[model samples]
Target: MASGLFHLAVFAVDGGPWEGPVSWRKAVTFGLSFGLTLITIAWVSSFVALGDRARNVLLGVFAADCVLEVALITVQAWRRVPSHFNMETALDTTISRMLAVGGGVLIVVLVTLTVAAFRDGAPGAAPDVALSMRLAVRAGFVALCGALLSGAAMIARGVAEVQTGHQQAAYHVAGALKPAHAVTMHAILVLPALAWLLTFTRFSEARRVRVVAVVSAAYGAAAVVVIGVSAIRFATA
Candidate 1:
């Protein structure tokens, strides 16, 4: 999943700030998408009354975000297929709208849950345990779908962007498109982590396994920390 997300974020990153419509659109889309996401995460971390549940639910929360975003984008795609088949602008708008909805969902879920957490844990009557459970469940489902769909979108974009970037200019304008490039590199590590988690390996060399374990944990932890920071930001904001 992380591999897919990394590719998604980086695919078209080779384009400079002044590329064609697709490139320009991608830049704007990613700028707002990624920027706002980071902000949300930061806020949540800073202000949310995160408890053991929130602190330990990293994978679940991320999954919810991915699900929400992907569902929105898919809806937009379904809408644009007929009338706006030939209209690139319409298609772009659809994608943007989907992303916006996804962002909105993230904000809502994080903020609401965090707020509830504050209320539940604060000095008051017994916290609404049942309600909290329901919310957490809902959040997890949203995160799962959101992560999968958004990851796919990002992977497709990354592949396209990288190809286009190579054709447009050889390492000339990797700055403006840095996000794509960064995600592509990130895929290398993330894919390995997924493999480690999802697949069984018969390794003759114990050292290799150890190395993989160490490196993957380090990389994954670092990425989670970054995401955690973003979550904190969202809570506060």
Candidate 2:
């Protein structure tokens, strides 16, 4: 997070449009996004019953991958080159492919954690808290999966355009899903935090669960609308 803030400060001082692939915005956004995501995953995973060694290994790899991805983006931004779908140079291509692979690793780790969340339940908590944690974590992970798929779509479309000799179009078209991608990615933190906050209230377990359900439904609906619009735009682009 501090690194992201520093990048933001630099961006402010340097003053550039935030729309391009090589913009400082990419570095700042990825840094903050992945950093917060790492923290959220670690927190949420604590409620799951993964053994200590397994948890450590999974999170270790996840954390390292996040850092690597962000570092690559930051490096490319500093080099004044696009970080994704840029095949102009061997180094750029390698970095772009590594980012894609990092995304796959993220999906695997989160899927494993999500499965554990469902399978083990939140041990050593009150029933209400347990239920809230379970629903929040599950729903969050599902939304996160949506985010990942949308990201993959963006990369695929961008790479395809690049391959077809439409380099500039690749950047424009690849961002078609950015709105949906951003909206869906943070559900893991928002939904779980909401559930946790409700636990401190006087609502019964059933009421809390009901509230979480309603919120999740609303979130899902919003995600669907964004995704539909983005999909249309992507297709047209």
Candidate 3:
């Protein structure tokens, strides 16, 4: 699923008016729409701050990016105008609508929690409160990581396509690393996330700060390890 999306981006990036039956606006919309979608996920995942204020800041960033992506998609739809007469175009419209609906769901959850934090803003009154805070933080963090990994993987495939030219890039791994490297980086999000789960599993709200801290730190480190390797290649390049 991911690899297909990556190549689709490449197809759109290099496409334009010259490509008969293809809308330049649609191509750009597709790339930016999906691109921002991935970043929204990453920004939240990487935020290590457990404080209420920190979570709010991350949520704000994600929301803003999502709005930008949606606006672009709307403009594209306006210009191209969906074909009521065509089955495929209707499918595209349906899929895009689904994406927006999903975004709305995230916003609702985000706002609910954010509002609660504002009303309940105070230092932990009990161990359970502290535990709940850490759990929310870790869950958000993992989600952000997944979003980023997907975006990077997509970008890397785009690069590979550019290097290999159309057909070759479509089928083979591109640029600095093999396809497996990209897969590994993305799949690693599960590791630290599992650690976090183990630390807080079904326990009552009364939680130990030290244990939560240890788990979150481990999760952060796991994310860093994947990022660090990707960074090394970028720096050398």
Candidate 4:
């Protein structure tokens, strides 16, 4: 999170419009988002029972990739060039491909974690807490998949535009799904945190589960609406 705040400070000093892929906004957003996401995944993973070596390896790679992604984006922002889908130079092409490949790595790690969330129950918690954690983690990972899908769409669309000689349009059109991407990305934190917080309340175990269920449904509904709107905008764009 400090990385994000530092970028926010940089953004203040740099003083530019907050739109565009190359803007300070990208640095700040990626820094904060990736930082928080790493933290959340680490926390949620504690509840699941994975082999130590495998878990450590996966998380280590995930952490490195998150840092690498944010660092590249920040570097490009400072260089004042488009960060993704830019092939004007050999360097830009390399960075763009690296980012794309990093994205694929993220998907694989998260998908593995998501499957584990469903396949194994939360260990060492009260039954209610376990149940809540289960629901929250599953829902959170699913929401995260939505974010990944939207991100993939953006990259695919942008790459197509870049390939067609419409370089500037590539940047603009690629962000058509930003709303959905942003909205769905953090459910992993929000839902699990919500479920965790409910544990301290007077609500009974079954009631807590019910509450998580209702909130999960509400979150799903919101995500659907956002995705639909983003899809429309993407189509029109």
Candidate 5:
């Protein structure tokens, strides 16, 4: 909400088609959407996790990372410079590097949560709920990891492109990975929601799990296909 409002404010003041790298409007839009989505998923996952201390710590880490990363991206937008793989100035390079490190931290935190989840049993919710939460976390972990890895790859490619004076190509190349990364990132919400919906159905617990397993498999496969297609397109383009 705050991000969207800030984006609108910048757009209003800077009126007139201002197409530039790291557009403030876009930065804030993504900041709010992705930030809120991540926070929400993390919060929900806490219930699925076992330990209170671990859950609290994970949420804290997630919240801090969200604020820090989005803030850096937004700052870059305000400065009218590209946020990703930008090394035009020492400061820009520092911010960009920090964001990349932040991404690494995020991946570490999520993977840790995933490991903890498997070690500790599911939450004390209903059978269906527990099952759903468990599957959601595991599946979400896989998809989110894919998203992070692809994002890291995009960053690496972008950096290489910038080095070779093909800055525009960097943007085009990185875009090819966006769809796969984005689709997988949303698995945290999609899978859980599907599970929740199944809870309302007349199916037995076993049936529901079976259905969820099939759906999860299909969903994961689709994400893989998208990733492969994106990679091929990027290479060919």
Candidate 6:
């Protein structure tokens, strides 16, 4: 919430210069929103799968990663420069590398959380809710992996573009993958929200579970289709 407010404050100020359609202010807004969403889902899922100590440590790491990432991106935005694939100067190069490291940490933390979920079945949720939350976290992990891989590809291509003197091409390359990445990254939130809504329905436990199962299947299929479209777009471009 603080992060989002800060981003809004920054947005209100006149940014002297920005990159492309995504200004640094807008990027920070997106980053803060994504970070908050991640934190919320992690907190909720922790109750279902992780013990206290493990939950604290994981949440701490996740929170720190989010904070650091947003800080770096926000700083770059205020400096009126590109945050990613920027190697024009030593400072820019260092910041870019740090951002990459943050991305790696995000992938590691989420993957570990997902593994923990699988290691133990859902504990705090009702039978149907447990099924939905478990599936949601697992699907969220899969989606996060897709996001990370596509982002990695984007970073690599962006770097190549810079090396080849086509700096603007960096952001454009692998752009189609953003939709797939963004869509999947929120499954943790969306599916779990759906699960929570199910709890209020008049359906019996069995019916709720069946509905969640069908919803999960459909969500996964939709995610796959998005990824497929991204792949085709990337190939054609």
- Residue pairs with backbone overlap in model 3: 41-144, 42-144, 45-141, 45-144, 127-207, 128-205, 128-206, 160-174
Worst 10 residues of 1 by lDDT: 78-87
Over the stretch 10-68, how does candidate 6's per-residue lDDT look in tens digits?
Answer: 76685533436247554556576766666665656553566667677777887887878
**Residues 113-156, model 4: lDDT tens digits:** 87877765444432333687788888999999999999999999
Tens-digit per-residue lDDT, 179-230, candidate 1: 3323322333243333334325454345444554555456545545654554
After the best TM-score superposition of candidate 5, give how far the Cα of residue 89 lies from its true spot, in angstroms. Answer: 1.4
Q: After superposition, how far is residue 1 of candidate 3 from its true place, in Å?
A: 13
TM-score for all models, in order of appearance: 0.28, 0.94, 0.33, 0.94, 0.86, 0.85
Worst 10 residues of 6 by lDDT: 120-129
Worst-scoring 10-residue span by lDDT in model 5: 120-129
Model 3 TM-score is 0.33
Off by over 4 Å in 4: 121-129
Candidates in descending TM-score order = 4, 2, 5, 6, 3, 1
Please give the CA lDDT of all the candidate structures: 0.41, 0.87, 0.44, 0.87, 0.76, 0.71
Q: How far off is residue 16 in model 4, in Å?
A: 1.6
TM value for model 2? 0.94
lDDT of 2 at 144: 89
